[model samples]
Target: MSYMKEFTKGLVKENPTLVSLLGMCPTLAITITVQNALGMGAAATFVLLCSNIAISLLKKIIPSQVRLPAYIVIIAGFVTFVGMILQAFLPDIYDALGIYLPLITVNCIILGRAEMFASKNGVGASALDGLGMGLGFTLAMLAVSSVREIIGNGSWFGIKLAPDFIQPMTIFIMPAGGFFVLGCVIALVNRISDRNAPVRTGCAACPNKDGCAGCGTDSDVKEAK
Candidate 1:
């Protein structure tokens, strides 16, 4: 694919958070405010970009048996580096993000791209993929947070917007509100894009078929059938 395609696909076509449903943990948790969403998005994008490049460079040397563990180590190192930078320079955001900052090491978007794309592609392509996916993830967070903050707190980025007669619904900032907003956003995106849900035809048709246990083992496949 062209470089532009690789970079643009994640924006909407294969968005990590909205379309693929990756990284929902931090998405739902930190999206109560726009500042928190931006902070988390920036941190995650940094880690994803660095880790994708590093993994692509090391793919040849890292054995298949240990690739997963090695990828985790590389991802964790970048996550740690990001954490220190955040703590020193952006302490408020660092504290606001809390454990979710460090949890980026295990984020499915990073690892999935490493396993499915970065390890198989050249460094330039991997970097673009990482950047695209990261930006997509960030945009998704911003969308969710914007709705939550505006409706829940009657503000945008902490600035009050509601009139004196209007009351902000406290529920929009709550956990239940996160789910509701996420579902609504996903529905809206689907409607706007007019995309149909993917059809699942079992192991043989799965993208991860090569690594899937059922597809990897004849006995398992027979049993599943």
Candidate 2:
């Protein structure tokens, strides 16, 4: 793919959270508030970008036998760097993210890109891929958090929208509300992307084609082998 295509695909077509359904832990756990969602998104994006670049630059030297381990080490290094930066400069966000921040080291979005794209592509293309996926993940977080925050707390980014007299629906910020909002968003994206998209069955016959575990087609298994 061209650099532009590589960069733009993740914005919607291959969005890590919305489309691919990767990185659900942070997506559901930290989206209780807009600020937390934004903080987590930014931290993940930084790690994704840095790790993609590092992995792409070192792909040739890293042995295929140990590439996965190497990718984890590199990704963990960047995640730690971002964590420290957040801790030093944005202490509140750092605390809000808490364990999820370091958990970015294993976030499928970062490791998936490293293994699938960065290991095979040039630095420039890999960087763009990371940028696109990162932004796409961030946008998804914003969308879910916006709905949850608005309905749950009558606010946006901590700024109240409704007057003092108006009552907020507290359920929207709870765990159940997260599932409801996420399902709605996923359905909406699928409907818009392909109104006639076929209903998929099991992984052996899945249609997503993005190579996610337990959701990929049989062809992916063959290719991996």
Error of 2 at 84 (Å): 1.1
Q: Which stretches of candidate 1 lie over 4 Å from their true place?
A: 198-225
The weakest ten consecutive residues by lDDT in model 2 span 202-211
User: What TM-score does candidate 2 reach?
Assistant: 0.89
Question: What lDDT does the true structure give each of the candidates?
Answer: 0.89, 0.87
Clashes of 1: 0
Q: How accurate is candidate 2 locally (lDDT)?
A: 0.87
Alpha-carbon TM-score of each model against the true structure: 0.90, 0.89
Tell me the tens digit of each residue's lDDT in model 1 across 33-135.
9999998899999899999899999999999899999999999999999999889998998999999999999998899888888898999998998999999
- On TM-score, the leading prediction is 1
Task: Please report the candidate that would top lDDT against the real structure.
Answer: 1
